[model samples]
Target: LDWSFRTTTRAAQKLPENVEEILTEAALREAHLIRKYDIPAALRVNTDQTQTVYQQGTNTTWNKKGDRQVPAVGIDEKRAFTLVPSISASGELLPFQAIYHGATPASCPDRKSPFYTEAEQLGFRLEPSKSDTYWSTMAMMKSLVDDVIAPYFECKKNELGIEDPDNQYSIWKIDCWSVHKSKEFLSWMRTTHPKILVIFVPGNCT
Candidate 1:
């Protein structure tokens, strides 16, 4: 199986051209199949309690520093890269898996993700808290793969001399969103690529 951590900017810059390249060139060159997909990042929200009081001798007052649920935007841009290379073993090409890591919740602060520490270490400034934007990025990547990369592969298949009719390929773009409210995206994915698998990863409570 092909496994990868979430995407990071640094990681994306270092990956090969396509998923196929990594599978063929990596040590797992003998494997018959490979699996690759983006892992949704974790998210966190502030939960504070508030109290209101009323008294005959004192003025009424209300406190509003209560709980908040914010979506995190972590690791989304860090692992976006293409892979497209295979090596020769025993003079025969083999099936391979390629993956491009996408975003994660750990990268966002409002989401209380952990990736902010790394981003700071890397000299990147954190952005202000905002609405969860992970799914938007996922959709964008899906469009890129569908509109650009897939067609390129079709064109190159003949020139590259690829002859395996059983060879299968897939693309996975991931993001974090509320399961209760993200039905729209879910529906879109189901209608567009019903065969693809979708996995959701939640954030740590602490």
Candidate 2:
């Protein structure tokens, strides 16, 4: 059978040549440092965010013949959020942080959402973006550190009996998102979470 297959190129291809080199060296250095410092797997964590739609899409659904629609009622095509999750090398999963669209949630209407109560019960935090396009920003990065990462770090430190602020360091591997590498954010992270060793993967290389 003669047929054609469509292929889509990824944005990662446009990344600079230095990106791979940087990523390779960073990973090697991180591994070396971890071994040299005897850092436990429990403290080595990697975090990433994935876009999630209010409604999930599927293919090959069971429907009446010639029917184009699958009847997804109340599905907001425009509504979306990012699910940021962290997992340590030792398999410890941290509570997810969700970035939702809007400056502030409308309590009356939003609180009634079916996903609202369950999201809260699962410890998913909803943070708003000024433009409703929830790209990570310096302020958001700071908020994540302050509201989520910092407290988690403290608790893990205490639980692991990892005292001595110097050796209490944890490896935080995050993608090299622009905001994550911003000067203001870096400065703030360094000063605030001195025990956290932040490592950035190649830009868009994830």
Candidate 3:
């Protein structure tokens, strides 16, 4: 569950002193469980959420040599959102969710936009935070599990000829974020999804 960052700048993140030991044990346990349940490659999913901006541009520009002053187009980093992307070990890319920064449904872009239409046709989703931050909320987490995660498992199960996909043993790897580790969330998953084993990536590992 190491996040894949595209930016070149190195983040000042830290890791535990016993990271190697932790990773070794986790890896061993994961391998054992995967083999034990005969989990399909399509069911081993790793997902992550990242803060993203609306426009992608650079502040650097080629200017006159030794110019007294120079300026570059600014990137509107303020218009930010959260992107949740998931992928399976079988190299299948699931439809990602985009949580726009807003407190109401109106805050999101118009559904009539051609871009939105195309994205929707591809099973993409555009959600409103309905909160101060664009980060994923408890409700959003549920939506992600129900709308994207569960359906994906069901589809894979069908392909694997599983008679009971809802109860099939699978693995979902994610970071130990607060919302994800919440007692309520865990209970909901236990009660609603008896299977779909949740695994946490050691904090600050990468």
Best by lDDT: 3
TM-score of each: 0.24, 0.74, 0.85
lDDT of 3: 0.86
Sort the predicted structures by lDDT, highest score first: 3, 2, 1
* Candidate 3 lDDT by residue in tens digits, 56-155: 6665667999997777555445677899999999999999998987877787779887688788877887899987889988989889999999889988
Question: Would you list the C-alpha lDDT of every candidate in the order shown?
Answer: 0.33, 0.73, 0.86
lDDT of 2: 0.73
Residue-level lDDT tens digits of model 1 in 95-203:
2112223254344344345765554543332321123332223444344335443433344444455454124333232224353127765676667645333432222
Question: How far off is model 3, as Cα RMSD?
Answer: 4.5
lDDT of 3 at 75: 45
Off by over 4 Å in 2: 1-23, 56-78, 107-109, 165-167
- Candidate order by TM-score, decreasing, is 3, 2, 1
Q: How many residue pairs collide in each prediction?
A: 26, 0, 0
